[model samples]
Target: MKLPINESGLAASQLIYGCMGLGGGWNRDPIQSEHITQAHEVVELALENGINMFDHADIYAFGKAETVFGQVLKEKPTLRENMILQSKLGIRFPDEEKGLPARYDFSKSYILDSVDGILSRLNIDYLDVLLLHRPDVLMDSREVAEAFHQLKSSGKVRYFGVSNMSAGQIRLLQNNCNEKLIVNQLEMSLDKIGWLETGVHVNQVAARDNVLPEGTLEYCQLENIQLQAWGSLAKGIYTGRDLENAGENVKNTALLVQRFAEEKQVSQEAIVLAWLMKHPAAIQPVIGTTNLARIQGCVEALKVTLSRDEWYTLYVSSRGVSLP
Candidate 1:
């Protein structure tokens, strides 16, 4: 279940626990004792189940998630050495001083300040990896490179990567940076099939209309960037409202997932995640569930293997169309 993070030689669990839902909710609430207790339980469960990588972001629960997680580390000081911690930066919420809409900031000063805030909130000396949360249209690659250089040189961040960026955007940053970008996190699931559809529907009229940017998957694989899939379960399609009210295609796909789960004697969540893990790119699925049982159920994915025909069956059903 361990995978190498490119040439950095760092190994992380194939499954990453996402902490977006940890701090009581995604609002500006203060971190309560209950939040800390919940986070501690989730972290312990993840570690006991062989999941060592914990994903975080400065904006998750308005930073309370990291605050709660930091409290867990404080109470159990020895747990820090056993985990791979990664957090994201660069997403700026709207503030009164700016009086502007929320946007991304990749300036050297902003990057430096953001990392400092992350470290302070998490009560940690450094992050195993730091990811730029999103691509900023006004980003200066040189400035970002300078910030990265400072972070690496100061031992603040061990590795660097990005999330929700196109291949061209990643190239622009990687060209100027000394470190190789090792990971690109994107929304990929059985329901969110744009990443797969674009590849399958190539060279025809359908290909041009694909919403997914072309060549991103191929580019990441070719460059040895580990593609981490966010929303990997598609929000429990079988149990979600999409199954009850959606068209036949959506329902059929959900039914197939359920059938596969039953046949494999695993949870439907595992079937969905295993579908993504079956790809050749060695994609890692970030599980965001805070439910302990659901989190434990997700580990079944590591044991479920789909055949080539079964994989295509789920793919075409989720796409709501056959391969041309």
Candidate 2:
């Protein structure tokens, strides 16, 4: 269940526990002590199940999620050495500034200032990794490289990566940075199958109409960049659906997932996630559920390996049409 982070020779759990759900809500609500307890329970469950990497972002619950996680670290400082902590920055919510809209900011100053805020909120001096949450169209690769250099030199961050970025964008940033970009996080799941569809439909008329950015998956595999999947379960469409309320395709997919789960003696969630892990790129599914049972169920995916036919069945069922 361990995957290499890069050539750094360091490895982390194949399943990452996303901290977005740790905080009670996604607004500007004040973090409560109960939130700390909830985070502690979830963190303990993840660690107990061999998940050592925790993912976070500055905007998760408007920063309350990081605060709750930080409180857990404060109460149990020894746990820090047992985990890899990663957080993201560069997403800015709309503020009081006149005529300003919610946007991304990868400017050197914003990146630097955001890291400090993340550290202060998390009560940590350093992060195992820091990801630029999203692409800022106005970003200057040179400025990003400078920020990365300063963060690394100051011992504030150990590794750098990007989320929701294309291969070209990653190359643009990598060319200017001294450090290698180790990972790319994207929304990939059974239902959200564009990442797979584009490749499957290559050179065909259907491929021309595919919305996925071509070559991103292959590029990550070629460059040895880890692929982290954000919405790996597609919000429980494959595993948690009520067939009576679902459409024909969803109901059929759920039934197929159930059949596989029964045959393999695993949870439906494991079937859904294992299908993703079967890819050659070694995708790491980030599970954000706060439910302990669901977390344990997802961990079962580490043990369930789908056969090629089973994989294709699920893929075709999800696509609602045979591969072109």
Candidate 3:
């Protein structure tokens, strides 16, 4: 069964694959046109593996990402019916376009203009999901909602959501929004335990990795919003030598991943997916790996389960201490 997406109730996969780093068009010092071909291969792989949701943002590679994805749709017109295409608006990259500082714009005219740019570039009649890339502090939610309402009423966009917003901010938007706020794109991971705001002893055990946010899971759960986890790889902080620096339980959990992967005949990365799946809250991982084999490994994680003891072992390791 397709999962319920917002109040409009579109069916979507629980795991939404992110097409950011995989696209090769984002932030490349010298972006090659040939890289777009590689991006299509990723789309092919996603379709082959049953990943129906594709995430995009207008500011990505300065609209080239949307163009690349549009090419896929145009080349294979039939694929559009089966896939749920999503894109973001409101992030203006002035540095990329005008060689000036970048800024966020949420004016009604700017929102409509961005939507047109998204539609023209994607070559789609409408978007399955349209999100505000980030919150604009001066955003007039009523004016923004007017555009959303018009878009929804016109069948140009089916769903509305926000990215990287606080619970209070979402409520503020929802208060003005006639349509429901569907998802909150967030940065979440095993190493980043801030989602649940799990009170861990950082100074006593290990220094906190500033990469992950704190208390997002609990807040999202309370607000009835979905969390999209980004950069979910087992890299950084404990890259190699610091694997020991990461703390003892962390080591045990890693050993556990090796053991489980061996037992299940899957890659260690699959164990990471399994661990994320164990969370009670809806954690739709936005995986960015372009490698097809690695992508397959992530899918394998969905099928595998981490035992209760093992889940805690990793959790304890993440905290660098036994659960008190």
Whole-structure CA lDDT of model 1: 0.91
- TM-score per candidate, in order? 0.97, 0.97, 0.85
Model 1 misplacement above 4 A: 239-242
Off by over 4 Å in 3: 27-33, 96-100, 198-216, 234-253
Clashing pairs in 3: 194-214, 194-215, 195-216, 195-217, 249-317, 250-317
State the lDDT of candidate 1 residue by residue for 18-38, as single tens digits.
999898997876778899999
> Which residue pairs show backbone clashes in model 1?
none
- Clash tally for model 3: 6
Q: Alpha carbon lDDT of residue 61, candidate 3?
A: 74
Model 2, CA-based lDDT: 0.91
| lDDT tens readout by residue for model 3, 120-209 | 878899998888888798999899889899889999888888888777778788899988778888766677766543334334333264
* Superior candidate under TM-score, 2 versus 3: 2
Candidate 3 RMSD computed on C-alpha atoms after optimal superposition onto the true structure:
3.8
Pairwise TM-score winner, candidates 1 and 3: 1
